[model samples]
Each structure stands twice: as C-alpha cells, then as structure tokens.
Target: MQAQTNKTENNTNRATQINARDQRVVQTVGEAFVDDPRIVCRDVNVFYGEKHAIRDVSIDIARNQVIAMIGPSGCGKSTFLRCLNRMNDTIDGCKVTGTILLDGMDIHDKQLDVVPLRAQVGMVFQKPNPFPKSIYDNVAYGPKIHGLAPTRSDLERIVETS
Candidate 1:
C-alpha cells in the first residue's frame, strides 16, 4: 500500500510539474508580444514566382492607431493589403510566407476562412466612388443581404445609422 501511494504521488507531482511548465511557456509568449500590438507583421514576404513583391517586413500597429503604407507603384502596398484577407489566393504564381497576425492569430492559417475574417476586419477601398443608387437603397443593401435586419423598419434604422 505504501509503495502504491508513493507511485501515485510521483505521478501527481509529474503532472503538476508539467502544468507549471506549460503555464510558464504561455505566460512568456503572451508577455513577449502583448506589451504592444494592434497589428503585428513578422518577417512578411510576398512573391510572384521569380518576382519578389514584398521583402521581409515587420511592423506593429497599436490600438486606435492608423497605419499607412505609401510607396511608388508596384511596391506592394496593395499586395500587402490583399495579404490581410488572403486575397493573394486568387493570383497565379503569387506566394506569401512568414507570419501576419491580427489580434495574435495567424491570418494565413488554412483553418481560418477569409470571408468572415474580412467582414470583421472590414475594408474600404481607396477610391471615393459613391453608390449609384439612392442613399436608402445603398445603405439598406448590406443589412438586407446579410439578413441583419428582419423587417423594413429595422432596415430603415440601419440605413439611418449608415
């Protein structure tokens, strides 16, 4: 009985040690990046076959901050913007590597779907074209399509908010 008790105690101690180690690893990783992040791009690169579009780039965007990328044409500002939503997926021979994280989750992971990811992150085009339809129709379209509003009155409220 004493030998069995010792064996059980040894197993319990091992589990406790493992749990402690895991907690330390989690804490260390969290602390390493959490001090500053609204966006973090690490060693990001984009290539179109032999053509390199974006070189290794690392940047951080803090909360409530605006980040702008400006450069001559073909310098990868749009390439990098498309990278945010994996829009590069459509281009032939386009390849992207390294890591881009939003709120600390890998955006490029195969498990992450781009559609909803885009809806949440949101995007407004650089152009200033207004909707051709009436303001009411223009504003109502999104909520109606997405079923965000169940009734006409609800859609009216959404259009007003827009």
Candidate 2:
C-alpha cells in the first residue's frame, strides 16, 4: 500500500513536469517528414475535456522499422500511441484532433471501418493476450479470420512458423 501511494505521488510530480515542458514552443528533434512513411501524424493534439494531453505533435514512421516511445511516466507516450489505432475512441471525454494516416489511408475517417483497420494495424503489449484455449488458436486467430491461408495445412504451417 505504501509503495502504491509512493508511485502515485511520483506520477503526479512527473505529470506536472510534463505539463510545464509542453508549454515551451521548442522545435521537435529529428526530421518530421519522410517519403515512404507507413504512418504519418500531423499536428496531432489530444484533450481530456479542457486539459491538453498532447500538443502539436507530428512524425513519420516508415514501414518495417521499429521505434521506441520513451518518456517520463505521465508524458503522453501511451496517449500518442493510442492515436495510431483509434483506441482513444473508447475513452469518455477523450478527444483527438488533426490527422493520422496509415499506409496513406486516413485513420480518423468516419467512413473507415475500425475492425479491419485494427486487424491490419495492431499493437503488441508486454503481456501476451491469448484466447482461453490454446497456443495454436492464439497464433492462428488473425490469419483464420482474414483468410490469409486457403487450406488447413497452410494454417498449420503458419502457426508452426509463428
């Protein structure tokens, strides 16, 4: 209980630091644009009612490249990543503005279906998210639903390879 209380206090301090940092109009480090970007975010902002969570953020993430989100405890790393897949939509009073594109398609488009978009672009958490049953089912679930494999043998092979 003491440790939990300490953690909460620490996070509160970090949140205050993050808020102060966001007030500075410093230029973002590194090049913000790229030619072959799989994901593009432009002037992205997030608000929880009146509180600005993320401010004027932009970046280009190229395909087949790995990137890390590193920051202080309350510095909006998860908030920005959530914008990539519209996970923020589930949160009440959370609103995201500006643009996010995946493979040149608008992620925030009202006409875009979220289910298949999520299937195409998904996040891997530190903990594995599995079905109730088996390892094979967990590995094969995506391919099975998307019809990536035409036959049972192919599915088995895909599972084995995974």
lDDT of 2: 0.68
Instruction: Compose the digit string of candidate 2's lDDT tens values, residues 64-112.
Output: 8777766656667777777898867756789999888999899999999
Model 1 regions lying over 4 Å from their true place:
1-34, 128-162
User: What is candidate 1's lDDT per residue for 21-115, written digit by digit as tens?
Assistant: 23221111112123468666666778888876665545555667555654455455677777777767756788998788878889987899776
Please give the lDDT score at residue 46 for candidate 2.
89
Which candidate's TM-score is highest?
Answer: 2
Off by over 4 Å in 2: 1-29, 125-162
Q: Which residue pairs in candidate 2 have backbone atoms (N, alpha carbon, C) closer than 3 angstroms, thus clashing?
A: none
Give the distance in Å from residue 154's predicted Cα in candidate 1 to where it truly belongs.
28
RMSD of each: 18.0, 10.2
